[model samples]
Target: MRAMAYRGPYKVRVEDRDMPCIEHPNDAIVKVSLAAICGSDLHLYHGMMPDTRVGHTFGHEFVGSVHEVGPSVQNLKPGDRVMVPFNVYCGSCYFCARGLYSNCHNVNANATAVGGIYGYSHTCGGYDGGQGEYVRVPFADVGPALIPEWMHEEDAVLLTDAVATGYFGAQLADIAEGDTVVVFGAGPIGLFAAQSSWLMGAGRVIVVDHLEYRLEKARTLAHAEVYNFAEYDDIVVELKKATDYLGADVAIDAVGAEADGNLLQHVTSAKFKLQGGSPVALNWAIDAVRKGGTISIMGAYGPMFSAVKFGDALNKGLTLRMNQCPVKRQWPRLFEHVRNGYLTPREIVTHRVPLEHIAEGYHLFSSKLDGCIKTLVLPHAG
Candidate 1:
């Protein structure tokens, strides 16, 4: 099998590797048909996440056919086409029973925080991801869902992470009808969050980003007002003005770890590793939302302490809700939305690369070249 292996920061390559076999009674081996390079994967590529070991394959959003399954995997069989959520969990765990699958206690050594995530760093769980030709899925019955006959393969793959997490973020916001929501970052997650906000009855949606291309997507795809923070002297103040000086009813932080507005924060977190992740976007969220409003976070961050505005949030009586999204929990409604033609997840896809050219794909995405919004990996492409 050929897998994308990490050699060091800013380095990865396609290398021949041994194929994974079922290691647990509930495990299944999937022959990956479609995989995506999530924006969060850049954290590992840039050495932002801790314990991202060399030779680790970094990918979490993927969909495929079951190549093999253990005896205990009763819900699926070999040849079943499935979409596996990013979470790896035991369905009967305390957290899983409560629909908090991302925090399942039985799957990860770091269960005190996040549960097992495919291809994320060791801090989440050391499981290999689906960036290769195949991947082993644990607790297969709980996490893998058969792709609906009406769904496109591209939509099924995005549901594994980006679409699900974005909708979850908006759900956490508890948006009231006619509320104004402002989303920070215009990546796929942010774009989806902005779009989802409208479905949740938000009267207005605004997307903030420094990139013109992404802001353009926000305007067209999400139907949200757009802002380029780079053009503002103070983006929070600009957001306040847009909201008639009271601030938005809700604010969301979708940019994590590598947020660029504050140079010192970005240096301390991303370059120097002094903080868990840059809190510029989060702080902006706190400042941009009105008093007693909500702030929902979907961005990926490390486990260490970050320099955030906790005191201000408390003073303003803001509801701060954040967690690694319970991906499967958001699927039912998301599936309905996709089926009804309310969303076409594949529209956000800008680049598709063969598994062998993934290193170049990573470079193109990281460098923000070619107007790249989302990049899909074809593991079995000719």
Candidate 2:
């Protein structure tokens, strides 16, 4: 099997590797058909996440056919086309029973925080992801869903992470009808979050980013107002001015570790590794929203200290909600939305690369070249 292996920071390559076999009774080996390079994967590519070992494959969003399954995997059989959520979990745990699949206690040894995530890092349970020709899925019954007959393969793959997480971020906002919502990044998640806010009855949606291309996507695809943070002297003040000086009713942080507005914060966290992740987006969200409004954080961050505005959040009585999204929990409504033509997840896809060219794919996405909003990996492509 050929898998994308992480060699070191800013380095990866396609290398021949041993195929994964079923190691647990609930496991299934999937022959990956479609996979995506998520924006969060850049964290590992840039050495932001801790314990991302060399030779580990990095991908979490994928859809594939079951090549083999263990005896205990009763819901699926060989050749079943399925979309696997990014979470790896046991369905009967306390957290899972409560629909908090991302925090399942039985899966990760380090379950004090996040549960098992495919191909994230050692801190995320050290599982191999689906960027290769094949991947082993644990607790197969709980995580892998058969792709709906009406859904496109591209849509199914994106639903595994980006779409689901974005919808979950909007749900956390608890947006009231006619409320103004401002999203702090125009990446896939932020675009989806901005789009979902409209579905949740937000009167206005605004997407903020430093890139013109992504802001253009936010405007056209999400049907939301867009702003380039780089053009503003103080983006938070600009956001407040846009909201008539009271601030937005809700603000979301979709930019995590590598946020660029504050050079010192970016240097301290992303460059020097002194903190977990740069909290510039979150701080901006806190300052841009009304005092009693909500702030939803869907961005990926490491499990360490971050210089954030916790005191200000408390003083303003802001509701701060954040977690690694429970992906499966958001699927039912999302499926309905997709079926009704309310969302075209595949529209965000800008690049598709063969498995052999995935190193180039990583480079394209990481460098934000070629107007790349999203990139998909074809593991079995000819």
Candidate 3:
């Protein structure tokens, strides 16, 4: 079978690799119907993740058909379609018992912890990911949920990542009725975060990003106000102006670089920092936050160590809750959102490419061109 393997740092190639088989009783085999590229996958490509070396199949968000399941997998069968949860938890761990499935003691616990994850790393369970013809899914019975009857496979793909991350972001921010919220980054995660914030009763939701196209999408589709970081010399001023001189009650960082740094300098002063950008979302939120606001950092943090100005954190008395999306905990509820037609996170998908054209897709998406918010890869469509 052919898999898009990381032949080297930033060098991805489509190559023949062994097809995966069920190696554990709790495992299930998914025939790759569709898989979407994620922001985290970029970390691996840039060689920022641990042991993200040659030959790793890179992808975690997927909606696929179950072609086989082990005997122990009762709820799921060969014919049932499901969305693979990004996190694999045994549902009985110290963390899982408390509903903190992201920190599952079994699969993908933390680097300072123990866990497993598909195609992530040995530190993340070193399990094979779903970027190939067939990939094994661990903890299948407990992890893989049937795609709700009203959901389409492409649309349900968000349940595997972006939408879940969005819900996770708003939940962390403690958004409530009549609260004004701000989301930095208009990419898929940020877009979803804005939608989720509005759904959670936020009085107003504002999305900040440089892309005019993205900002338009946020306003027209997600129905949120947008701030063009590129146009405004000071985004804080611009965002505050939109929010009555005060800041938003909650600020969610969906762009995961130096916390929200973009490619170019001067779009944000922090973006041009020679001292180094450190989750500018922290600084952006601090600058544009109401006195007692909440900051939620849910973007993928790479290994390169950096620092944020916590002085603002102390002064603002902001409640900082940071974590990767514990998809295990957010999936069920997000699916509920999908079922009600309250949220359609997949609407951000701008590119749907055959797996073989991943190189082209990656280039187009990495460039953020033509309003390519997200790209879905169909590995077995060939």
In terms of lDDT, the poorest run of 10 residues in model 1 is 268-277
> Relative to the true structure, how large is the alpha-carbon lDDT of every model?
0.90, 0.90, 0.76
Candidate 3 displacement at residue 295 in angstroms? 0.5
Summarize candidate 1's per-residue lDDT along 108-137 as a digit string, tens digits: 986488999999988988999999999999
Which pairs clash inside model 2? Answer: none
Query: What are the per-residue Cα lDDT tens digits for candidate 3 across 1-382?
Result: 8777877655777888777888888788898888888866765665556667577787788878898888788889998888887887788878888877777776653465545566775567666677777788888878888887878888777678888888889889998899998888877888888888887899888888777888899998778987777666678888878778877888988877542243332134445522222366557877788888889987776555445668878887888898766786786677677778888776788888888888777667766667787899988775
What would the per-residue lDDT of candidate 2 be over residues 1-382, giving only the tens digit for each residue?
A: 9999999988999999999999999999999999999989998898877899999999999999999999899999999999999999999999999999999998889658899999998899999999999999999989999999989999999999999999999999999999999998888999999999999999999998878899999989999998887677778888888888999999988888763323355544332221223577788888889989999999998765676888999999999999999999999999999999999999999999999999999999988899999999999998
> Pairing residues by index, what is the TM-score of model 2?
0.96
Which has the higher lDDT value, candidate number 2 or candidate number 3?
Answer: 2
For each predicted model, how many residue pairs clash, with residues at least 3 apart or on different chains?
0, 0, 9
The per-residue C-alpha lDDT of model 1 at residue 157 equals 99
What's the lDDT for residue 74 in model 2? Answer: 93
- Enumerate residue pairs that collide in model 3: 107-116, 108-115, 108-116, 109-115, 116-124, 116-125, 117-124, 258-279, 259-279
